[model samples]
Target: MNEVFAIADEVAVFRDGAYIGLQRADSMDGDSLISMMVGRELTQLFPERDKPVGKLLMSVRDLALDGVFEGVSFDLH
Candidate 1:
């Protein structure tokens, strides 16, 4: 996880209640960590986007909710 990498100096992996390995957080990336945890190399973590993205369906500029939020802007397709 991002938090784990951010806060941990070293990372230890356990799979099926068995200790796998330990390595420096900076020495590993998410895919490597995941591969160790799952006991296999990850080919694709996410599916490829098949459909082409459509045009923007909505837009919000300078949106605010009083004291909750301010100057928010985004576009959605």
Candidate 2:
């Protein structure tokens, strides 16, 4: 994304083969790009959950996959 902005003079955004809009590379951000592509404002892109997020939903500690990777870890809360 950074590389695209640095090298491209202009950007043409599209959605489902429909032309959304064209923008200068220097004048765009993630939110604006998403909004343009989806035809919705950033605020409306994600739904608001009624329940608040609570404590640790899941946790992965020192997970390793043989022959592929090792020592991977993460947590979802």
Candidate 3:
């Protein structure tokens, strides 16, 4: 119930709607498909981050999680 699911082409990403950290498994499912979105993938595509902006790139990922919890829960068929 706490988990929220989102579709991204052939990938789906589950969000915590609380924490911003992409804890190991949280970033990918069992199919070896990535659980991160295009933007998240772009931000984390590489790890040569030794600059200021690069360090803060993942900072706003909270909105992705926050967007889930901030709204009213709904029912769909």
Candidate 4:
């Protein structure tokens, strides 16, 4: 018998009534995770290309989750 492992990277941005999601193959490494986060910009957080890292790292205070399928990921069989 054998066991397989997979790691996923995700970034979700919540809005007034909806949200955006992005995913990439991020492994168990700091540099890889940072690179993947930098690459995927399909949300408001990374909406602008010239947004500085400092701005990007700002505290997203009091963030809450409210959705029909909150915090769920989709996969194909």
Candidate 5:
């Protein structure tokens, strides 16, 4: 995780209660770490979308969540 890389000097991966391996946090990336944990090389964690992005379908203005958040606005396309 980002936190591990930020604070730790080395990272150790474990799977199914067994130790996998250890590598320096500075020398490892998220994909590689995940691949080690999963026991496989991850080629495409997120597949590419087939279709191009479309126009805006919805819009939100001045959205609020009680005492949590307020004045939130966004658009979905």
Candidate 6:
């Protein structure tokens, strides 16, 4: 997938046979790519009401990769 950033100047993401959006490789990241593919923010994609919270299921802390990935976090039950 990093090759995508190396060779392509732009990428057009899609869903269900429909065009989603056009974006530059330099501007893309794991979070943004997931949002485009899922059609919503990872947080908003799954609401608390969909599942009970406050159980301390799983957590990601201080994840970073210099300029590539930074302060990214998530949780799941």
Give one digit per residue, the lDDT tens place, for model 5 in 5-71: 8999999999999999999999999889999988887876666889987999999999999999999
> What lDDT does the true structure give each of the candidates?
0.93, 0.86, 0.40, 0.41, 0.91, 0.83
Native-referenced Cα lDDT, model 5: 0.91
Among residues 3 or more apart in sequence or in different chains, the pairs in candidate 1 whose N, CA or C atoms overlap within 3 Å are none
- Model 6 residue pairs with clashes: none
lDDT of 4 by residue, 1-77 (tens): 01111433444434444643444434234443444445543354446667534423333434447763354443322
Better of 2 and 6 by TM-score: 2
lDDT of 1 by residue, 1-77 (tens): 99999999999999999999999999999999999999887876565789998999999999999989999999999
Better of 1 and 3 by lDDT: 1
Clashing residue pairs found in predicted model 5: none
Superposed by TM-score, candidate 2 places the C-alpha of residue 62 at a distance from the truth, in angstroms, of 7.0
Name the 10 consecutive residues with the lowest summed lDDT in model 4. Answer: 1-10
Better of 4 and 5 by lDDT: 5
* Most TM-score-accurate candidate: 2
Let me know the TM-score candidate 1 reaches against the reference structure: 0.56
Per-residue lDDT tens digits for candidate 6, residues 1-77, read: 67777888888899999999999878897678778988889899766795546777889987899879898888865
lDDT of 5 at 75: 89
Task: Indicate the residue-level lDDT of 20 in model 3.
Answer: 34
Location of the lowest summed lDDT over 10 successive residues in candidate 1 = 40-49
Off by more than 4 A, model 2: 61-77
The residue-by-residue lDDT of candidate 3 on 1-77, one tens digit each, is 11322432233345555333343444555333332433355436676857554333222322334645543443322
